[model samples]
Target: MDGDCKTAVVTGGTGEIGFAIAHKLLCNKGKKVVLIGNDTKKGSEVVDSLNCSFGRSKATFYKCDITNREEVEGTMKKAKNDLDEIDIVVNAAGVWNDVCWPNEMETNLGGTINVVLSARNHIKKGNGVVINLTGLSALEPFPNSPLFASFGAGVIHFTRSFGHDVNFRRFGVRVVALCLGITKTNLHVDLDKKMLTKEMGKGMSDFLKNACYQKPDACACAVAELVKYGPPGSVWVVEGSRLFYYDVPDYKECLNLVSQFM
Candidate 1:
């Protein structure tokens, strides 16, 4: 990725998907990565592994609560000072908790906002890119996971708007929303037993059984490719191992029609 990008920050870099993305950036793209996550132990483990693979200083870990704006800012500053410039920022930190409504929403949506806003301030000019991970739930709601769907949908809309923002466009940073297909991740490990045993988890369980889950490593590669070449403000979907760009129509005509009534 010479002249394209150099340094990247992957939020939730301790998670499976995030880790894979970090690895792709470090090993494949040959870019330095600063990982942000709340888990010190897992974060340390991932950092150590990446460093071992790509030599020391290739990866650094920061334990941060993305929902906290101050912490996000501090982490971003430290990363910039440590890595010089941030060319890519991937908001992969998310939650699928049905039990904790507030925390889930805060993590998935609020945390994403914190990262995107802080990242825009630090990203390099003209070639910086921000990739926000959304999911199928965002495009189509699941009856059982209303909160999760809402969070995903919120992120998609926010990302699209950020991509369309005039000032943001001036920065020349590409913003993309990635609709990752169902993948095996730790998010499901502690799912409420009661919910799983009852109707709530049925939909999810069926979805998991039927959904064509992509491997984290493979999806990581696709994400790297998207970061390298995807158009700004576009949404890309990955399902059943298929990766493709999603078209968003120009809504000017609809807006014009509505403005007459207003």
Candidate 2:
């Protein structure tokens, strides 16, 4: 977090896991943390608390809805002016519409794109890192979230392959995606309800019960560690257990884990 580490921009920092990561970066790593979210109440509260808990460790909050491209861009401008440069962008901001299917994609996918676009400009010469949070459903589809599954899948590929399309190496930016499994975040509640009424909803409910989720502090630890151990194209899965990479065993283990829910 210190000594030339990039400034950390955590989208959705007002939320559960995002808050955890922001605190970890500040309290543990001493990173310059700027938390971005739309909830002024919660956002300001978190900033105030951080000022108390971590003694202001360069942590601030900004009002932004990542789904708004213009707002995201503007926020980036302000952030750059405040921090000078952005070294890491964590796309922890996510959404799921309880009443509709496609809104899931609109909120999650659209928001991610806006964050990535804004964050990309500040990353330089293999220095900046983008860590994205994707749900287990990104790979393990639930019938209730058909469109969400499709959109998440697209994001997975996009994160892994976008480097090839862009000159990140020349620019010194590293973009990696974190495929998160079942975690007890605010998103989990809405996701559980959205899929629970579907044809396969019953099993998903049971799956939720059996799942293990640590405190948001634990998740923050994992991401911070990954940042210390990353380059372009790095991927990690932060589950109840230790962090794991994407590979054959990951798919198989997750497949077995998926069976219990299906």
Candidate 3:
């Protein structure tokens, strides 16, 4: 790798959206990447494919369960030591299984906290960026999967709080959230089975049938654009293959809106 080459660490890099982001970062942006995931076999296969496509040593994989704080710290340390420095960290690992709500919360919310806290110290300050991937349920209520939506909302709040301007000024790292719309990925497969109840599952399935779905590549493209220009503490929505900034109202704004009705 060149002395000036940027490097990234992407959790859940073996998954569709995550892998797409890593590929975009490497092929288009000329960045080396370390893929973090739990499946060692899948991780190795992804690393091998990326290295073959980009170049030898351009990609590496570290087996890690992001929910495990100690494991995450160790993995981040190893990734930093190997890369010399990490310029970007993308928290793309998440679960949507409401049937296993505890595990879902642990993987989605807890895992994000672990990864960001562990990796922030080694990230290249001043220019480093952290992209936390949530879903549209964060912004809009999902009647079918309230548990999953709650996790998304929690992630969005966490991202905004951590990525606030005051914190950015002190740490010099830009943190942003990307709320993706319905995308064709494994997360969507057998959605009815992952729901909390049969009625909710059927309703969700019906709702999705009429909703617009985009490819994972579109989400990847959005991530690339955000990585380059997204501001700290900002939230972006990527839906129907379009990317746009999402305005999350502050407490004062909400208060004013409520006062209008009174």
Candidate 4:
């Protein structure tokens, strides 16, 4: 690894979007990456593929379950020890099952909290970045999968709060949220089964019939760009292969609207 190369830790690295992000970082941005996931076999295979394409030591895989704080902290420590320092941490591991909403919440929101807290310690101050992957559902109501949307909204709020200017000045870490829209991944498969009810599932299935889907590579590209230029507390949306910044109004700004009604 080159001393000047940036090192990143990507959770859920074996998945489509996560793998694409890792690939973009290594191949396009010339960065070293540590992939974290629970599937030992898939993790090793992804690392192998990345290493073969990039370099022998450009990529590494650590078997970790992000929902476990202890495991996440331990893995971050090991990754820091191996890489010397972590520059970027991408919280990409999430679940969308409404039937098992508790587990989904634990993995999506709890896992993100664990990784962000652990990474903050390992990441070098004054030059660290954390990208939390939310979903488009966070921006709007998803009647089909309310729990999934709720989890995304929670993550967005957390990212915004943690990435505020006050926290950034204190910790020197920039946190940003990326809201991805209907991407072509396994996440879309069996969408009905993942919903809160069969009726909602059917509705969701019908809703997506004409929806446009972007490839994972498009999202990966947006992530790479954000890693380089996104400001702390910023939110971005990627849909139909296009990326755009989203301005989240402050409490005062929202209160102004209520005052008009009064």
Candidate 5:
């Protein structure tokens, strides 16, 4: 490992966006990437693949559930020991399962609280980066998605407001939320086509299938760029195959642009 290669921890790293971000970090900038996820077997596989693909940068997978505050603290401690000084944290740990209990808040909201609280010190120590991902459902309300809507909305508000920017400024950390429209990922594959059609109404299925969604690998690359340059509270929206950048000041302006498309 290069002494200067910044260490980045990515939650849900076995998934497409997470894996793509790790791969891009390793292959593009030789960043030491540590993947955190519950699926030890698949997560280890991603680590192996990155090792083979980019022998320059080091990659490893640690089994930790971000929802567990203890596990998050333990993982952060171990990762700090391994890397010396943590630089970036990608809070990608999320679950869409709203049909069963209150797992949505427990997993999504709890995981974020853990990730931010665990890495609080690192952000204070040096110029750190945090990227939280949200979805279009965040901006709009859906009828049947009673579960995910609130969580998505919470993520958006947390990343945009909720003292996140104040902390970034106070501690020299860069925390931003990337609002993704729709992407190609295994999670989408799990959704029943019929269910989507039923939930989104009839024509929505075709609209989704033909949507010009960005690939996971590409979004990952963009995230690495964000880590390098994007500022705090900057909401990045990648939609219809075009990457758009919007800050709070110009949000009204950007919102107007969005209205144009709508």
Candidate 6:
């Protein structure tokens, strides 16, 4: 591995899933991680913990809002200046909002765009990987979380499209989406309880209640594997402990699949 391969920038690094991924990167990949998040207190705590586990100066924190493009760009520049070129970028800053769809879209989809655009140039010259954290809702929408599903679907499509961006390809950067299924993360803390409960109904609620949720660490392990194995324009899905390449067929293929019914 190259000397520069040990540096990474992770958005939403204060969150449970993001922090887990950072931990995996540090322990398994031997990467120095710079965490970006809005919560200064939590970010500091996470960085301190990571540094303690890894080594002093191996982990750092940069407080920034991913929804703000300027803040994201500035953070990226500072990270690059401080840690040299970034080998990997993990976009884990997202929200599942049903009360306010527009805000949710801005945070989840727009924030992803801001991070990708800002970090595209600074990614390592070759073999740099960008992992956008999406959800199974992207492929299979849930009733109560329409906005969240929409954001994930948008992110999956955009990740593929952006993988073909001239600058991204020129830098040999690979962009892909990681579709996680029912991970135990803090994504639903701000959910509208009444709206979610009512929208989900009894069956959905029961299903969710009985469903087996993958732990943050388990999901993080799958994400780490995808970071190394996922090709440009691809999407990888993980359910429980099973991970597989997700194939999103084109419209023509869909039409063909339905031709018999027509």
RMSD of 1: 3.0
Summing lDDT over every window of 10 consecutive residues in candidate 5, give the lowest-scoring window: 193-202
How does each model score on lDDT?
A: 0.83, 0.73, 0.89, 0.89, 0.73, 0.81
Tell me, by lDDT, which candidate is best. Answer: 3
For every candidate in turn, the CA RMSD to the true structure comes to 3.0, 6.1, 2.7, 2.5, 5.7, 3.1
| Per-residue lDDT of model 3, residues 1-262, tens digit only | 1213689999999999999999988867555899999899999999999999998999999999898999999999999998898988999998889999999999999999998887678899999999999889998888999999999999999999999999899899989999999999988889888899999999888988898989999988888888888899899999999999998876786664435554
Clashes of each: 0, 6, 0, 0, 0, 0
**By descending TM-score, how would the candidates be arranged?**
3, 4, 1, 6, 2, 5
Rate residue 206 of model 1 by lDDT. 70
Candidate that beats the other on TM-score, 5 or 6, i.e. the better one: 6
Candidate 5 per-residue lDDT, tens place, 182-245, comes to 7877666544332333654333455566767778866776677787777776778766546678
User: Is candidate 5 or 6 superior in lDDT?
Assistant: 6
lDDT of 4 by residue, 34-96 (tens): 999889999989999999998898889999988899999999999998889898888888777
Looking at model 2, the pairs that clash are: 124-172, 125-171, 125-172, 126-172, 126-173, 127-172
Model 2 lDDT per residue over 204-223, tens place: 56767887876677678778
Q: TM-scores of the models, in the given order?
A: 0.90, 0.85, 0.94, 0.94, 0.83, 0.90
In the predicted model 6, the residue pairs found to clash are none
Q: Candidate 4, residue 2: CA error in Å?
A: 14
